[model samples]
Target: MNTLNSNPVHGATRLNDWGLIRASGEDAAKFLNSQLTQDFALLGLNEARLAGFCSAKGRLQATMIGWKASEQEILLALPAEVLPGLLKRLTMFVLRAKCKLSDASGEWQLWGLTGTDAEQWLGDAAPQTRWSLGQKGEATVIRLPESGAQARFLMVQAKEAADPALNPLSPSDWQWLALQSGLAWVRAATHEQFVPQMLNLELLGGVSFKKGCYPGQEVVARSQYRGTLKRRTFLYELEGQALPGQEIFHSEDPGQPAGLVADVASKDGRSLILAETKIAALASGSLHLGSIEGPLLQPRPLPYALTEPE
Candidate 1:
């Protein structure tokens, strides 16, 4: 298996290394369950989940990859750059909660596996934390049920035993999977610019409609139930750093910005970008960037349908 390594936790696909926050205390699950879009309290022992922390007005503030280490504790994996703001925001609501949140990325290692089968991954005898993959696999493979998408992203504590023989994926492999799947991850440029649904979070299980109140719940619910959303994320190919949130325009409407690049990456000589755009702009193949007037923003298939009009 192709691989890349990080000194903090050597010899594995240190895929997208990010900051980890360990939330602990009697009210940990309860507090987070009420805050994030996912029901963290019901998270299985060997499972990791994607959740969003949004503003009270139903705008996304942060996106998280979390796993419950115990009934009273959960490890929240989020971008290091986005951590400080998240902690401060979370602490603001700590008026009467029984939870303590701390930066914990230093003590753990995360990995991703690809170009190999799940059976082979299970055979590698590493006393690793078996994360749930849901309907995507053995609750270990990250899979999208409605979309039938399957992939594996795993984590290991730095102190734990990790064997290189497991044949993990290279960082690029993890990236390619995301690009191919047509998923757009928020980056520094696109930070705090989108609500969860704008990036198709509900389709990816990153948003929970049935969950109790949390930041941005009202707007998220409204967008889903009433289909009042004005924009949505899309996949497009270009060249160069796909500057997250960069504008995509068309020659016909050069005066007005058409779309924004949500994520960008260097693939071969071309760049693949996830852009959020209006349905009207995308219907026509007139999207352009720079002087390339006719460079069409070809729409790629997403894993799930956008929640539609009521």
Candidate 2:
């Protein structure tokens, strides 16, 4: 394993926790369109989309950042731990669709770029908007929502391609920056636990209410228009360690779980956690990491607004 360590303000780090999936064939785009929350059929060459792969009950099985490499090929970036199982599950659905799904993690490299290093790597070709795509030689870069004022980016290139030479960044800082952006990729521990809305995925452009039928389109759509949603994901600062899939508890209702930890990144003694909980729980009582006596969770503002689109 290649570990890069350097200043947190500006550097590039190998994202070992992420995996790549490639979908190819004449029906690649169309087949993905029918299974994911994003409108893959209309995906553009210059844009990437945040999407959710859900179960029939509308729980997210996996979440991904995907883009079109070509009309016949689409690339998806997701948690490596969940890749094999997801790949197997998706392959089972491609019976006669003319699409081939395979694990591409070993054939490609993924990197996380932060601050000036991100800007320097792409220079004039850097993508400005979130989820936008840019190209610099053989590397494909996707702009991500900023963590505070520091810009963030994801770069993908062939496994044999030369690595970008810049300062090295520790994995912890890279993960912290990603968590600060309030975006969480579904991991194996979190599989089939949350609906898109519960993670505020729709708020982050991860769900398409207007798209055609998908695995759980009706459930997702109903959650959107049926009534006011009572649960949502929020950013929080915890003084103690926390991990994804851990149960969160409320002070008022200590016997039962108030929510689930969607993602967590710890550095030093503090941690940044993206947890989904009851919206009402935020309004009154306190939240804890495991039990009512577990680490206290302090609410933090999200980088993006949570208002539902009109």
Badly placed stretches (over 4 Å) of model 1 are 1-12, 117-119, 124-150, 167-169, 290-296, 307-310
Q: How does each model score on lDDT?
A: 0.64, 0.88
Q: Model 2, which residues run further than 4 Å from truth?
A: 1-8, 308-310
lDDT of 2 by residue, 95-213 (tens): 99989998989999999988886698679778999999999888899998888778999999999998777688889888888887888888888999999999989878898877799
Kindly list the per-residue Cα lDDT of model 1 for residues 1-310, writing each as its tens digit. 1111211211236644567788999888888888889988777765677888887777667787787767788888776767888888888887789999888877766555443354344454222332354322222233222211443445444635454355555665456455655556666667677877778877766876777888778878887887467788876665445556678886567878876787665545556667887767766557776434635555555655676545
Please name the candidate that would achieve the greatest TM-score relative to the true structure: 2
RMSD of 1: 5.9
- Model 2 scores a TM of 0.95
Each prediction's number of clashing residue pairs: 11, 0
Worst window of 10 by summed lDDT in candidate 1: 1-10
